[model samples]
Target: MAEQALANLHTDSGMHGRKAERFAVNRASRILSINPALSGISIRSCHLLDISRVGATISLVTTIGLSDHYYLNIMGTANRIGCAEIYRNGSRVGVKFIKEIDDELLHTIVRGDFFTAAI
Candidate 1:
């Protein structure tokens, strides 16, 4: 399912072109905390489809009521990124980080090191 979403995004005519290369991390299921600092409402689960330093693609059960801005918590690590919605298609959403994440953290996530941090 995650792979299909990534492929759809690539084929989607609306893509403006990506700023950074994305790394496939479909094996991880991370948590999406909606405006955590403000509301503390967290979605049960969302899969990390692909990621880059600037943004990521997540798979959700439903996009309903999702705000334009939210916080994504990378499950196995103490990392939370502020994200702004770029686009949503069915259950997939493309988001851009409010601030770029460092390469070390990006590599850590791509390497699947956070798997041990998952609860």
Candidate 2:
């Protein structure tokens, strides 16, 4: 039987350095990457390793080798979750989900061009 294909994401502090300083959670809100639809010009599924309202770390495996770039559909919302490059071995590829619990900036990134998944 062929191996099933799916993906996941994970995240935490220190994933990104100065670029990812903690934002104040004054009026806290939860950010989730749902709507991983298999549509759109560039989109793929990933294993969500970890995530905060902001962003997440994720893992994906492809029988074919990975390209330096790709987009992530966070499995629920129409929003296309962003991703940055990460290590890869054989069919396994890793990336950081780009978004946060914060609303404005998060919307900005997703609303604009897709960026590398920062960690």
Candidate 3:
């Protein structure tokens, strides 16, 4: 369980050049470290900057050369948000989901909660 809410990414404004609106989520999450697909890399800690149904913004110390694919594991449940890198800005990154989240999950995050179930 290593996913934070999206309101903590220090972004009040929406992501640049994105069609969807991104909501800020200030919560804690962990990057999966032991994936065989991502060898030679350890788990990195990051914060959820913002999120939408299609994508999310994350803040990390360094996002250089990170795999284009990620499994954004949720903190409290057996859920993971699969995504692919879309853009990068120093320590921040924009990602597009492999599968979009549903309206229910959106409500949970906006209400100050994590995505507890797989969407």
**Which model scores highest in lDDT?**
1
lDDT of 1 by residue, 1-119 (tens): 33432332322322466446567676455555556466667664788877877788899888887888877887666887888899999999988888988999887776663343243
Give the runs in model 3 whose Cα sits over 4 Å from its true position: 1-21, 33-42, 113-119
Instruction: State which candidate, 2 or 3, has the greater lDDT.
Output: 3
Using TM-score as the yardstick, the better of models 1 and 3 is 1
> What is candidate 3's TM-score against the reference?
0.67
Task: Write candidate 3's Cα lDDT for 30-119 as tens digits.
Answer: 666445754555577787767877877788888865878877754543567888888898898888878878877766665544443223
What lDDT does the true structure give each of the candidates? 0.71, 0.41, 0.66
lDDT of 2 by residue, 1-119 (tens): 01111112233445454244322111111222333373435334555443345444455445243445455554434555565556665544445555434565444433332222321
Question: With candidate 3 superimposed using the best TM-score fit, by how many Å does residue 65's alpha carbon deviate from the native?
Answer: 4.0
In model 1, the runs with Cα more than 4 Å from the true position are: 1-19, 27-40, 113-119
Count of clashes, each model: 0, 35, 10
Error of 2 at 93 (Å): 3.2
Models ranked on TM-score: 1, 3, 2
